[model samples]
Target: MALFSFYNVRKPRQYNHTPIYWDPRKEALEERIRKNKRELGMEEPLEDYKPQIKGTFVEGTSHLKRSYNRGEDTRARKYKTFKFLLWLVVLGVIFWILFFK
Candidate 1:
């Protein structure tokens, strides 16, 4: 309402962006040329590419990691449940002593 417009709020400005065009065929052609040069000894081939495995610290250790995480979660959940039950018992005792005893 104009009558309730005590604070003036300005609209956010629009962003004008110009997108760049990518040619996949050109990229593949350049990649092939580089590979060919490396094979022909024109360009020394880069160090043997060993892809890093991000799933585990060591190869075939993902299962161990998963089990460790599962154990930690279960232990924490059990401790939390034990604490909650202990508090509930203490409160129940206090309530019984106050009202019935």
Candidate 2:
């Protein structure tokens, strides 16, 4: 038989509960709008004017796709060259520090 009960082991307590408070000024403004609508007895508001379009606007063409792909390839090549030059400079600095110092 066990000498002590395992239930006596203390459980971990939570430490991350942050309380949120409501703003009284926003609530008062919303209540005032509700009171105004009730006094005017308005079911729906007037619709705003919207501009109409005639034709569809095609954003991407075959030429645009080809140009975009070429730009991406040139960017990738430039990034690779920049990374290689950066590593070369770092290695040269390390070599100078080890040999000259």
Candidate 3:
């Protein structure tokens, strides 16, 4: 009987990578040149307009909206609270009967 299993074990693969050189000063200089050309009317400005994508988290998840809409009406809120409490009492009684009695 084999105390240890070598069939499931394998050597990790070697990774060979060549690092690329980057110059932040050169990149900044290129950006500054583009901005100067745009300011001087030598190059047309690139339209980088982004549309607004804003929405309330409450609106996105409708459970909040449902509760909020119901809350605006006093009668609806009372009825919902009453219904929840009634269910809670009923479940409590059932649990008590099963476990204690």
What TM-score does candidate 2 reach?
0.30
lDDT of 2 by residue, 15-81 (tens): 9966598888999999889778766866333232222221112124564456455665557767978
lDDT of 3 by residue, 1-101 (tens): 87778897767999998659888899999999999999998987675222223336557777767876656455777888999999999999999999999
The numbered model that scores best in lDDT is 3
Candidate 3's clash total is: 0
Q: 5-41, model 1: which lDDT tens digit per residue? A: 6477677999998769888899999999999999998
- Write down the worst ten-residue block by lDDT for model 2: 49-58
| Candidate 2 global CA lDDT score | 0.68
Give the winner by TM-score: 3
TM-score of each: 0.30, 0.30, 0.32
lDDT of 3: 0.79
On a 0 to 100 scale, what is the lDDT of residue 90 in model 3?
100
